[model samples]
Target: MRPALRTRRACRKLATALMASTVMLAGCASAQPAGTQAPASVSARPSPEATGPVAAVYKDLVYRSIDGTDLHLDLYTSAHANGQPSPVLVYFHGGAWARGQRPESWRGYSRFLQRGYAVITVQYRLAGEAQAPAAVQDARCVLHWIGANADRYGFDVDRIVAHGTSAGGHLALMASYLEAADGLDTPDCEGVPRVAAVLDFYGPTNLAQPYNGAASGRHPSVVRWVGDGPGAHDMDVRMSPLTYVGPDVPPTMIVHGDSDDVVTIDQSRELYAALQRVEVPTDMVIVPGGGHGKFPDAEKARVAGEVDRFLTTIGLP
Candidate 1:
């Protein structure tokens, strides 16, 4: 993983240097499940250097997973608030579960860090390295460890949100919809931790469907994660968030690109509808022609605005 640097600029030249390879999204819609729009004055595209009264300080740590991989985390705590740790945001980056790393792929989330919030940019074992449930298990362990070590970091006990993009989005939603552990017998499965909320960005809700072409071409990563492909995927129902539904879930916010070819709009749409059907507080924002995270300026701003509203509505302070 690459090192994370503090950004004082609004738009970054680093992200622009490499164009991600993926199909582009055409149009996406906004479906807010809660919260009113922000006042007209807030600049949607503010720089990382641009923040309110809150001042941010960045830090790092390693949380061990079930497989013993030294999962890395980039934590940002507010400098303006009391010297304490404050609310922590556990964030996972999107790269189809096989690509991406903390701080290397995402720069916009520093906004959360600036708000007197401790933001965690973490890395888990990829699909190829370990099969399904391993990543989820690792994520669960990190959350519990973060909560367990709250005193060490001065972390606020009540505010720990699971946030992610693309594949990361799927993982975040899973944190809410699925059990913290794989099953009843897994080690350290005792006294598992749950998230306060879920923030999903263009994530695929159901991986049972093949991607790119057939199951082997585009969905090999998912197949590897599940330890099965196509017909065999459903047997790993324990890994799917959709399989576990009952009302004990935290609020959820979903953002997707309507034209996204990588994860498909139906993925987010299906999740939003399912969450609403079950009366789980949820929001869905679909950007027009926004394919993947490399969206145009206007669309990206809108997505960020939607996220801001979601977090504030849930009382993330």
Candidate 2:
């Protein structure tokens, strides 16, 4: 059954906490303060891409957050749910978490389904509706729902790979890193998703950075997610994969367009450095001349192959 979906309300608390982070972003050579930040807006909506043959195979499902906030997702599996377990790839869409949908990111997303991996594209609350952890929480809920339904969906829970592009990448990384952080025995509200690998595509890893600056055109989205003040550093660190680096993290892959204009390639660099620092099995793929949403075929294939290799290495494929 499709879960009833709800756009989350933007809470004053989350907005207030982001004030300091917002200020920090403004000081960047290219960043602006929130007041000076451009008003929230979206690019012209992308034309719908054809879903291809595999889209015909998967089922559509929805799940609610722990708080019962509605979230939607699409699941693409093999011909039969009872077939032997296969590696699973879950994706979150970009749009800065403000105005994108899972289906709109489909040309590349569909390509994954044809690779013999079960794929899921999800829709979480956007910044316009809520903010930071709200989107993260929604993504995590979808993963948890996947784990619970794996038996019926024909995938191994431990063989999953969590991945996302841009803002979605941040959420994906946060979702998995939260699991790693849970090892600290922190509060239960800290959400986590168990996955064998992470694919962060030019994701923002530092919330306190200038990329989220008001002048950067991403300030509103960042502010919506984390809030408007410095105290939100706890949430920032909590969301940052850099904060929980350890050997326990699944083998990881970082793919970024070196020329990405929306989220800087440096974010991927930071994540790569942190992963290397901890001796986590990691691979970094830099696609030259690719800008935001402009990945070439070869680069896209490389991402698929890397995830494929990660799954194969762990006996997940």
Candidate 3:
């Protein structure tokens, strides 16, 4: 059998066995809301720096700023969604919350666009700019911005989803689980809308758990992101996506590679267990020998299929 097929079959077997054994488990973008008028300083068109073809695209739309540094987002759709609001997928890039830029390959998301989904890629303040809560706060802000301006962007506020890989995955989960009352608020984004679903790719769910990754605990980069000193432990719990898991978390799909040495497989496993405990709708797809984000093309295709089914199951188009 082809490697992808073999991987898919093994994953299915693993999922089935886990379900029978434990009854199991679970489980961007910067555009403003639909009708909120943009300030004169914000531009609605793609910046000159935006490259590649897309049905329609907008870039560097400022969502928020801290200490005068503007955080922006890029949005794309197969066409100008006019008549009806389209479903929105908010993507956060993975760089251990310390580095990484919003993905620039418009074509990389063609499959989702062809499936009638609008993609919104967001840039958050990284560890270099700030620290742990800052990225989470920015993530929550992006969701609220989408809701406040859902009409302008032609997306259903109720149909917004979060997708991310690695550290980005943790942020995506936080976007879905963090409560507005829990201090994820900003002057502009006071409340966070419910996340429709979450797609997590090999994300570290629990910061408290030691995973063998460059971003793991007390690593200079992580310490910088989470802040240093005696209170770091408390801060770690607060920033952990795993800490936020509860009944209110939206439906979720988690894909992890069993052989992943970066973020240990146990991270996802523990999360799956947590969601299962809460009886949340959750699914796990394990690539038998996959690495962090480097799965075979066939395996990637399988993941795409899983995403489609998960979205549809959660009532998204």
Name the candidate that leads on TM-score: 3
RMSD value for candidate 1 = 15.0
**Which numbered prediction scores highest in lDDT against the true structure?**
3
Write out the backbone clash pairs for model 3.
26-282, 28-122, 33-148, 33-149, 34-149, 34-150, 34-151, 34-152
Residue 177, model 1: Cα distance from true site in angstroms: 2.4
- Candidate 1 positional error at 128, Å: 2.6
Query: How close to the true structure is residue 212 of candidate 1, measured as C-alpha lDDT?
Result: 61
Q: Which of the two, 1 or 2, has more TM-score?
A: 1
Report the error of model 3 at residue 134, Å: 0.5
- The count of residue-pair clashes in candidate 3 stands at 8
Candidate 1, residue 52: CA error in Å?
A: 11
Per-residue lDDT of candidate 3, residues 103-188 (tens digit): 97567777777666788898988877666567887888889888877767677888888999998998899888776545445556
Q: What are the per-residue Cα lDDT tens digits for candidate 2 across 1-317?
A: 11111111222233344444544532221131111111111122222332453423333354553233445566665433244675678888888778878873434554455555777888877766655555665666666667666666666776778888888888777677655223221122233347778888788877655543476433465666666555454455545556555666677788888888777788788778777877888888888888985888888787678766865676655
Give all TM-scores, in the order shown.
0.74, 0.72, 0.81
Cand. 1 TM to true fold = 0.74
Off by over 4 Å in 1: 1-60, 65-68, 83-85, 104-107, 180-186, 210-212, 215-218, 229-231
Candidate order by decreasing lDDT: 3, 2, 1
